[model samples]
Target chain A: MKCPLCGLEFNQEDGLKGCSGCKSMGACGLIKCPNCGYEVPAESGIVKFIKRWRKKTDESK
Target chain B: MTVNLSRKRPQCHSTADMEIDARRSVVLVGSPNVGKSVVFGNLTGMYVTVSNYPGTTVEITRGRLADDSRAVAITDTPGMYSLLSITEEERVARRVLMENRPDMVVHVADTKNIERMLHLTVQLLEAGMPLVLDLNLMDEAERLGMRVDTKVLKERLGIPVVATVATKGMGMDELKKMILKEDILPSGPPLRYPETIENAIADIAKNLDSSYGISKRAVALLLLQDDHEIWQMVRDREPERYALVDAIVKHARERFADPLNYIITIERQRFINTLIEDAMDNDQVKGIPFRERLSRLSMHPVAGVPIFLGIIYLLYEFVGVFGAQTAVDFLEETVFGQYINPVANRIVSSIIPWKVLQDLFVNEYGIITLGIRYAIAIILPIVTTFFIAFSIIEDTGYLPRLAMLIDRVFKKIGLNGRAVIPVVLGFGCDTMATMVTRTLETRRERVIATLLLALAIPCSAQMGVILALLSGSTKALGIFVMVMGTVFLFVGFLAARLMPGERPLFYMEVPPLRWPKLSNVLTKTYTRVEWYFKEVLPLFILASILIWAGRITGLFDLVIKVLSYPTGWIGLPPEASKAFLYGFFRRDFGAAGLYDLKTSGALSGVPLVVSIITIALFMPCIAQFSMTIKERGWKMAVGMAAFIFPFAFVVGYLVNLILNGLGVVL
Candidate 1:
């Protein structure tokens, strides 16, 4: 995912900066948009999975 | 407006995090994996996986749906039971209702389980959320001999209800039309309880001057039952108004035969019964009865704990001993150690002129040598096996039953059954499990669970190595179990005594057990492995780089010197301190580090046992530390750290003292 601030993609969950900032902030549970220091929530995995599933199905069709 | 700390997570927070400002969006909300997401893809014209089952998505997703100027934004929400939140997913769903102020909500229910599903719809209606009810899986419902009366149900619900077979594109146009033309303004009739209760609610509402998004009556009912967030919200809105409201609730309790909340709930059920009478053809038969009976047995006290232990042993045998020991040896020793490492070392020695650059790639402790090797050869294979096993277990619907089974024992230890999720997840990886503690009902429960996880329960990586290390000696395994049990009980007892607030009750829905679908398990395992590999690799490399930097700067030796004193006090070798320190980096890495010590013959029986105990009870892995700070905040996280670091060694020292005093030889 592209970091909003840096426009760089880190092929990982949470922040791309190895969660250095969040570790300091003490909130590694939140998803850090890998590009910009944006912290999003980590909610239910199934819902997000299905959302992705829907997207894939649509694209294939 | 209150600043919701948990809000604004795009990736893990909310599906709509990125798309909130759009003119319109489709919010794909439903039960776990009912193809709401597949339907979302069809609507948005985007690429997303269409999997059978995997309950991993914890956040919202956004996409745009368009068909010739009928453009709308789409959001996929986590599965939730009701508007009255219990789980974090439920809280997120409720927050979406208030914050986004959606023009319409797609209440996707599995058409087969309409009885249980419609309870949430009634709550959404009661909360006055604008909704278009989509009965997804109409085909599956029909195949199961279930027929829903859509038109009558819509009339009864006072909203447009659309029948959708989402995977096949059934009823798309009707659903779209309902979303467009159905009244955005909710017309749900104000549900009335008996006159006695109605009179009480009217009194409560009249006194409650604070205007809420939900009706005051609903808020009043919630407040009496000690809904913390709702109580705080009302307190913030009208600081002086609580006394009178409290009096009203007390008065209602005196008059009511049952707890007012229970009474209100029963009334709501009766209301749902009448609605179903108009809208549903209730099916009395289900195919999964034997499965249901077995599922129930797994949770019963006599059978459940043994079943739980049996499952744990199977997991230990399959994932820990077998996977981490045998499979890992093959991958790490035979494949990577023999072929890859030698080849890479030769290539690096030949190519690099600078000694330091070569050191970074393939030296005694090179990033490529240790980091890449551990991540790929060791952690990769072990976690792959774990994910496959976990996926299979989850697919068979056994985990929830396991939770129910454990809830009884958990209660004795000052936790309820719901604590089972995070505790169980701790076995997978404590970092994610610590984050999952947000699903707990109260702060005290979260704190207690977090502490237990940090102190006693081994994350899967750590479990893998420790299980492997102890595999040779059955006595060693027994001692390990005994030490772990002692720590769990001692810490749990102290925490129960110290933490304030009453223990929250747990109620879980146990889905039926079945033979795990292979295709479903495979997909889930693959996705998890993808997610896991993404998490581990960089951290491993970074850990190596940091250790290298520490070495270059003399910080590593300085800290090792500091740790060695504690190491000696705990009756462990000085080198064991290095392993303990690195254990903070990643769990398995630390264990692997200890393997180096063991191979060097620096640690033997007593010290080895002490070291294992100490590491097991040491501070949480780095990821968990990060999550603890995130979920519980820094003061508590640091305080937990402050207690853990000193306390772990203290326990180790004490264990050594006891063992030595008893003259025990393993």
Candidate 2:
């Protein structure tokens, strides 16, 4: 995911670590961009599945 | 994926054979988010999960290149800015390069940010590693009308430069070829420094006969910069010459007013400027794109306020009207109230028989009835909608511009524009925002920010309910904004005056604005909802148990009776005291309670507006209170809570008195 603030593309896990390190309550479920400290929400499994489905459909077309 | 380095090493090999057949490692290093991972993926064709680097929690990714010619170990180090490490991650990146002693060092850099990233490139060169300069993200650079003359840059730096759009598999074959070759690029000369510093380097280098994985020149520079780790390494290696090295560094420091790191950086920047003059071209024209124009308009002081207000208005519409009134009501009334609660109550009453156990499960403040219901019915939809709106704001890259727009005002409150990050975040969760205050530079700034967040900022859950409560009365909403806005500014101004410290400097990288992707927005909302539920469900259950305990012990009533005095003082009815008491647990819980009161016609006009202002300005929820204590220490957190609790009622009372005295009615 691209960090909105710094525009650095990082894996979602790196963002989650950044969020956890900040001692957030985990309620926001945001991944902090390790590069610029901007918070981004992680993609859900359902959302990920939908995205993959959409891409597969697009490819089929 | 695998954070353990020990687990990652190939096992069951003889030491001799291991030394002979060990793949030549190609280590990738760069500042964070430069697509180093993408490049690594392209080269390796394998999955490498991020894990803590050994004992330290810093994440590092290691993979192996799939090549017919030979096995190549490809390790992607954590992002780092410079070799003179300040952060733990930077130290880890340097450690990977130093300890691995890789055959090739691929310095990946974002093409658009070459000027800033070149400083790291110079540091890498100084380390005397065989370097390949991978100028990644060429697509983004061209889109911004930036063109880098790769031939000129390579010629100037004396390294093989490869331009790539890593995401699209551009330039990977050449990158792989360069990595596989033994003698791809010559070891370049170390970055030139001022004559005085160069003399010091030479003096220090003369005594260093031992090989450090990196060049002696780099070690000498590290020594000059007072890098503690390098100094220790030198002390352990060359105890006899360590004193001499220290004396040289001390002498060099004495000669310059500024630190050696700053001096070195300035020199590197000067060299980069010279390199850029011949290599980089910018065809920036007056015909800016619509997105760029919108970006500028967002940061314009005059126009930005309306834009900011418009965003807030939209937030109120979505989370307040749509989520709170529409979704929350349906979930609360039809779903939970009609079906879930009644069925659960019957089961608990029939099976359990004991009133205490039954109440714990299905009564008014029962864990299952109230806690789960509030988490699912009241807060979830509201928070989800808020996250969707917030994701749009974030993905569009409007946040940094908002920071720039409010920087001038933030400075007056002893904070720079950077404080906008935590402040904007406070809207989502004050607990998280309190923790984020550590990102601020000074203790004074963190304390001031903490105080403001506790006293004024309402979390999304609370904001949703407050917006819903006030949506019916324009005058009430207007007065609520006026009252809370006044307290926010007034306290901030006083806090700034009271705190003594150097003013923080403001600097932020503003990303270009673009349309938010729907997939991203939906995913963000879903993740945030999941996270919100995971965090709040337990807290809500615990709060219910605690409230149950308090009710049984008679403490709850006593507290409410004590709270009712202040509630009445703020012009709210005695029934509103329950909500204020609940506010101590979670700000949203109290606001939701107030929503119940307002809908039942228990509050109206000036009293309703006063209740909204008071709850909005109330002390932060219990979680934020504890977080403040953890981040800022007991005295500060307790002091802030002490101030905020009474201050909320005082401000609410003042607003009520003023409105009632003026005969203003909503």
Candidate 3:
């Protein structure tokens, strides 16, 4: 996902990997951009479901 | 050929193997999201091993090229913009390049952003790497009516160039051919700095007795730019020669008005402009797209104020009128008041025989009647709507533009535009935002930002409750906003004047505004609301218990009596002192206390607005105070709190005096 602040695109896992040292311990539910420390909310299950469904439909098309 | 793909870190590569394969390896390097991964996939085929780099959590991917004949190993380094790194990813990427001394270094760049990408290219060349400039995303560049003369680019940079739409497999064969070519040599540095800098670089390089894998010239440049890693490396490697190099850097720095890094970047950018002019053409007219025009308008000084006000108005309508009033009334009145509270009271009364226990769970200030009701019925809908609105605004990419627009205003507060990130996030959660103040460039900026956040910025929960409390009177709401805004600016101005520090420079990228994706907005809102519930629900229950305990012990009344003196001085009723007490626990809890009083007809009109302003400007909650202590240390945190609490009441006292003195009736 693209970082909202600096526009750097990084994988969510990569972003989270760098956040291990954050004081919140990920309970804040924010995924910080690895490039800049800008925090963004992680995608929810509903969003993931919708995304997967959309991808499947696109592949079928 | 089966590629060895291991996800585990320890098993990925032995140190000896890494050293042995260094010469035959290829490392793909580029800024984030420039298609380096895609290019790596094309070269290495389906299977690749990913492991954490040694001593760091940053993942590094490695695989053997698909061509079994050469059996050349390829590693895809993390995205990095420059050798003088800031983020750990960039540092790891540079370490990979310098340590591996790869036979081929492919600098994958987005063709559409070649100008920005070339900054890294110039650095790589300066580092004397054997680089092949792969202009990825060719289709996107062409769609933008951009064309790059690859032959001219290759000729000018003295490196091989390949153009490819990596996702579509275009130019793959050529890229493969280039990677496979033997005898690729490091290109000479493409940029020559001013004479003073060049002479310094030469001087530093001549004194270097150690081989640092890369050219001594690159080390000199990194040292001149004050790259900490290079400084440490040079200090460790050339302990005797380090001082001589350091003196040379200091002498060169003395000759420049600006920082050496800035000076060097300007020179490199100038060289890149000429190179781009010679090798690139754009058939598309210079007409701004609608998005671009909108972005510009949003950052325009005069135009942006209305846009900012417009956003605030929309937020007021959505969160205040709709969520705070409509939804809150339904939940607080119909759901909790009519149904949940009655049932809870009955259940607790029937089960717990003692009146004290019963009151603890059901009566006035009861856990169920006040704590759960406030958390779910009052604060929930308001924060939900706020998070929704905030998510939409964030997804639209307007915050950075807002940052740019406010940069000038922020400078007066001794903060640059970057402080906007923490300041805006403070509205959501000041505790979390306090943690983010570390992003500010200077200690002074962080302290000021932290103070402003603690003082004037109301978190969403508190703002929502206050909005609901004042929703009845527009004049009251307007007064509340005006007072808070004035205090924010006045205090920040004073702090800036009092604090001694270098003036901060503001620079930020303003991404084009786009329609917010519903999925993204919903996801963000859901995550935030869920977090709020997890964090806040228990706090509410605990606050209720603590209040119950304090009342039983008579400690609560003593505190309330003492608090009521200042509460009365602010022209608030004695009952409002309870809210002020709660304000120390959580600002939103204090606001909710005011909400209860307002509903009961115990507080209204000017006193309501006065109490709200004072509470809004009160010291941050216990959590935020602890964070302040953590971030700023004990002395600073205590100092800020010591000044803030009295300052808040004093401001309240003054606003009350001026308003009543003017006989302005709400």
- Native-referenced DockQ of model 1: 0.07
Identify the candidate with maximal lDDT.
3
lDDT of 1 at B636: 93
lDDT per residue as tens, model 2, B457-563: 88877887788777656667667776777788799888878876555445556766778899777777787777767777888888889888898899989999999
| Model 2 chain B poorest ten-residue lDDT run | B13-22
**Position B53, candidate 1: lDDT:** 16
Across B430-528, the per-residue lDDT of candidate 1 in tens digits comes to: 876686677565677788889888888897668767765664555666677778878887888788788745554455444435687886666666666
Clashes of each: 42, 3, 0
> What are the runs in model 2 whose C-alpha is more than 4 Å off?
A1-61, B1-108, B113-116, B125-136, B147-285, B300-302, B341-359, B400-408, B416-421, B439-441, B473-485, B660-665
Q: Per-residue alpha-carbon lDDT of model 3 for B225-290, expressed as tens digits?
A: 999999999999999998999999999998875568867877888898899988976444255456
Question: Candidate 1 regions off by >4 Å?
Answer: A1-61, B1-200, B203-290, B350-357, B416-421, B436-443, B473-475, B598-609, B630-634, B654-666
DockQ of 2: 0.37
